[model samples]
Target: MAADPPPPAEIPPAGPSSAATARAGTTPVHRLLPVIVPALAVGVASALVLLGISLLAEKLQDVLWGTVPDALSIGRHSSLWTIVVLTACGLVVGLLVRMVRGHADPDPATTGLVDPPLAPGVVPGLLLVTVLTLAGGISLGPENPITAANIALTCWLGRRFAPGTTAELWISLAAAGTIGALFGTPVAAALILSETLASHPGPGALWDRLFGPLAAGTAGALTMTLLAHPSFDLSLPPYTHPHWGDLLSSVVIALAGAVLGLTAVYAFPYAHRFFRALKHPVPALALGGLLLGLLGALGGHLTLFKGLDEVRVLAADPSGWSAGQFAVMAVVKTAALLIAATCGFRGGRIFPAVFVGVALGLCAHALFPSVPVALAVTCAVLGVLLAITRQGWLSLFTAAVLVGGAAVLPILCIASLPVWLLVTGRPQMQLHEDGTPLR
Candidate 1:
């Protein structure tokens, strides 16, 4: 009874101060620890993973289509063959995902547009799948995989730094920065992140999220400059400058762009549903491939893939293309993208979207005969991008840089404003059943 009474003298609960004292007593103090631990670990891990995946994509591209007798032969392929290839790829992808759960076999329509950022553990597969899809004539681009990998890497690193505090936010910023670096415009990346990040929050939460974006973007830019990766291009034309006429024309062009952009938005979801209705990835994919082939049949091989070579060629030498050819290319390329995107092929709509804008812009320039080719192309590119992305500054920068001149910046920026307004006001796409924004 006496011992029980003594034990009843309650031990006071440990307070925060006591806990801190205990922690301080045991915590190791190594001055080199902080610097050595996070920087070395995150940096090296990110670099190795990114580089490995990048090399994998390159090698896979070579394995699939590098041995072509000629790049032009890409267009000469038959629609049936394209369909067959697409179906086979879809079959493989579906089979692969069959056993996996929680995003193992991503649906194409849901993959880039609707899905959240991928985890690092799944990035390699995402990269591999995309590379194969693109190489095999899927109407997609590298941007999806690039963005996926970037966010995945950041999430992986962030989790290591702090168990789970704001990991998704960090991942989002990393995604923006990576895209910005890839596109060679940090400002655009910031704008895209801002627009994409905006949500109806409780009062001050918006500002809270911005911090990670800024830091991530800064880090990404540093990485781009230091690494001297392919995305470091900042080329612009010195001689070019915007004329008053360019501004006026851009306004008109933006209206046209709004129509087309909205059309794409509307068509995209329906196309996705059409493919998904098939309920079988293989046949759906094959049908998409056949459609792609048929589309390419009209434009030749240049219309295949995500249209990078076409963009490159046009950027380098616009004279190689005629008005008719550009129009055909635009239609075919758009169709191919719609099919590939809606089907189970893993890829991005961004590049193909840009290409379509460029084509439309060039076509408008040709048909009108009043707008300068450069001005029209620049305006069209910005308009379409703005329509698709609903991002202001990013679209402005993209319009300027991709066209290679600051002169068009004024026109591009001015024109993009209205287009942004209109497109942004339109109904948000039903990218997911729950009405959430696609990644």
Candidate 2:
């Protein structure tokens, strides 16, 4: 009104100082406090949910593999029973997928460790199929579905209560929580998330970005450890001395494992296309189960399911089997993993991949007898995981964890270099809906 109001004092956009002040306002404690509580809740919830589903699956597995067979006076894990149960499982899963909402999630082949939050309506069917897969001795694991379910639940609830928080935060917290529970360690969550979260743009240090996830991981890990008492160490003879020969053997075995895993990777898209050609879940999954049953019969019971216990069994008596037996087991497991993954099974490949690595490593040890068992196993595991998962840190961590020693670490680090080169830029095991490699 009066003299144009002095043209209004010109206000400047936020400069470096203002931005710094804004950043300062969100101090580590201040930023962490808001999400930490929710993160802890998510972590505990994720662990409990994982444990519940696992326990349920175990009970079902006991009935299917033990009680039913025992009552019927049939040999447990016999070939006939294996075929019957697997085929029945396929029919059940197929019926569920055909009848249930969300169809138990898109073909498992198209999913990965971390995916966008699924609809709440989809979670129950996903969980049911996951349970059936686990109990039915499917060659996959519970990681993908459990993680997906937790993420869905977390995001669904978080958005209702804390509308301001980003969906990414919920995803990180849920994934970290589930991974911690699954691996029984927050360190695994940190390692896995470091690879996934590195490129995410944010206004904080790496640790700052990891704060909520680490908290969730810690809670989930503690919950799982206290409840389940899981252990990854195989109690293999420790490797105390590092020699030139061991290094040479490690590199050689690791490269061989990489090549074997690459063969599967190359075959994955074709296998998926072959299954998808059927164009219906029922026949595709039923036929897949029949094939898995045949594989279980051929590989004995060791090649069935997600393979954690089978791996321990193999590790318990690495020398009990002939090199030929080990070779057959490794090859059968690789094929089983390929079939389970491509043919509409709802599980993870990592556990079965671990089994493959252990079998391959033992095969190497059985053949040579001079190489250290720990070194062979670690290197083989590193190579296989590197080729299949394409995760360097995880490959190294899993390899080191299985052996439970620092002595093999340097060798594994060195061995991974060449193996990494072999697998770099290769097509991943995952595929698109159109059956193209996900890469």
Candidate 3:
């Protein structure tokens, strides 16, 4: 009743208050505390989860390659073992998908790394199947499953622990961390996210938006490097001297690789449709395993796994492989990748694709001895990645990272121009709705 009851005082929106404070150049230190706390928490949490998943996979890999072969009294690299292990892996995954709740993770052939977060309850099955797939020498990478698991775990933890952290923000940090750990560098995360993060409207500068993810990525990458995990760099001869001729050669080699990759891309959906034609998961996957076994028998143990180590070993001594041998390895690797992706295996194709590219590049170099090995490899990687991922910056970054040669950076950047032109508007290595391609 005092002065007809003054209207209740309205509280200003927190967003406006923060914006006005920032504009006035007088934002309090506490105003930034929320961001800093969540960023650090996400960083630490990302490192821990990534570390656990990677180590579990690594130990399983040891058993698959070491203990199992020893128990079977066969060399770990024996062709028979490769065939048996891969075929068994396919059946195991099929059985789990048929029996498990949520059918484990979604089909990786139809999914990408940045898909929606996975259901928390489904992670254990996904992890188990992923380990089996990797240990059995499935031509797929841990990127998709690992990234999904990290996102699920991080989002749950953020909601429970950091109420201020938004879901999208947490997901971004999780992906960055997973990528960083996989590539052994925060730079990889930065390059991949550059286009994505810049497209969104956010507070502060673009760098500010990148700050949290970068922190998380750094933490994950550092942990991975400390554990002596495999890296993208193959320690190829450094391109200390960049020649103009190399540019032409990079384009030529890259185009060749792109052609090889596109061949596989075109075949991907057809292969998928063929397997799915079985009309059921078990028989389809089992048959797919049989095909993979045949591939293993042909390609040998070197072509069986995700291909990082195999690619490294191949690149280390280019003189050891003749053009025919390199050609066979590339063909077999690409075929295995296609079969593995289509056959209901829960894995990504990037790692295997890199292997194919390395083989192709080595073949190209062997054919044309005048072409620098590093240039051939970088260009091949760029072209194959463009065909598969359809991401220009990622392809470029990968090419640069593979060589670790500053001289090669400009060459890759320039070579990417033509590669993109060739690959743009083509079908990606993914399935489409209504059985049509994205093209």
Candidate 4:
């Protein structure tokens, strides 16, 4: 199913609305009413926004794909076209950032863990720009914007009504719930939120904290279902059941994935810094696009865009490509992604990373002729991003979920084990407090 469109207007949470916060005399239950009502409001509003965004995205995609083949035919094969579109996208991003000046691009890593919430209006801008970039093939995904908008929308509503908990916690719950609904797995999103929150110090005990997100997740999931969001039934093909030996192979694959993940984390920050140092967003974006174009030239069109459609297409028909081409695709995609991240474009890194890993897994299966291609892709995706995101347990489960194969469960577990070992030690996510850099 196609993804729902993002929120329409960027609505930042109106600042503290007179920091008095829920009149000191209100009863506990009475106070609770504010949060509860707002939470529900957020769910409904966000769903509507997402639906609109999805429709817009579909229409936009039609225009883009229609023009793309013609552009390619006219010697626009080099990533120059991607760069041109992305540069224009960067300008749009810049214009919005300048206009609303909301949380720049609604960074994904910050959302899942409950970082301080942005003003309410932030969601719509993010939704609009992300839709524009993604639909235009700017090498990013909608997931970040989706999750960010959900969090922002909820927090905005919460602040308007509740004004009790720290805006930060509400923001976290908003993020958790949004992710939960989007993925159609509230448990996983809640776990991810809990684990992420645990990584840092905050008000409220684990149980107290879990209450909001659990409710939010339940609500979010309901919203997804009622709206018939495509993610409502996220499932991959079932692979052959895992054998004991497959577990051993998983360990090997996990280790490899972890290494890549860690490297990505370490490298991304530096790449981002390098481009920012260049100071000119246009030149930096153009340069990033040029590198992406070179990668596309080598990897074929598969490396182009955000790669979500490609992932779906590949999963549906894994037999379409030979191993060598898959391997090359993985390499080129990695380069393209690194370039995109380093550039000024704002979007999520996870999906693109998964795309690269999946292609690589397909290539590896071809070469080894032993491991199931699907299994290898699943393991690599979970293992690598777990390290990169610094969420081992979440990564492990996410990997298993991505594969959607009960038979491959053992293999997924095995792969995650070694990856876990390699990825030992909690890595801190870069977050901001009061909109200022924390690290």
Candidate 1 regions off by >4 Å?
1-54, 68-91, 99-106, 111-121, 197-212, 222-239, 368-370, 428-430, 434-439
Instruction: Judge candidate 1 against the unseen true structure and give its global Cα lDDT, from 0 to 1.
Output: 0.58
Candidate 2 on 1-439: residue-level lDDT in tens?
2211111111111111223326645555665666678878889999999999999999999999999999999988999999888888887888898888999887788788887788989999999999999999988889999998998999899888877666677888899899999999999988888886654444556787777888899899999999999888988999988998887899999998999898999999898889889988899889989999999999999999898888899999988999999999999989989988998988888888888999999999999999999998889988898888888888899889998889889999999999988999889888766677755
Each prediction's whole-model lDDT (CA): 0.58, 0.85, 0.77, 0.60
Q: Write the per-residue lDDT of candidate 3 for residues 321-422, one digit (tens) a residue.
A: 899999899899889888888878888777888888888889999999988888888889888988988877778888788887788888888888888888
Candidate 4 weakest ten by summed lDDT: 6-15
- Clash tally, candidates in order: 4, 1, 0, 21
Full ranking by TM-score: 2, 3, 4, 1
Candidate with top TM-score is 2
Candidate 1 vs candidate 2: the lDDT winner is 2
- Winner by lDDT between candidate 3 and candidate 1: 3
In model 1, what lDDT does residue 167 have?
44
How close is each model in CA RMSD to the real structure? 10.5, 8.5, 8.2, 6.8
Candidate 1 pairs with clashing backbones: 75-301, 83-290, 113-438, 242-407
Specify the highest-lDDT model's number: 2
Residue 378's lDDT within candidate 4 is 80
Candidate 3: list runs displaced more than 4 Å. 1-33, 198-204
lDDT rank, highest first?
2, 3, 4, 1
Evaluate candidate 4 by giving its C-alpha RMSD to the native, one decimal: 6.8
Candidate 3 lDDT at 164 equals 53
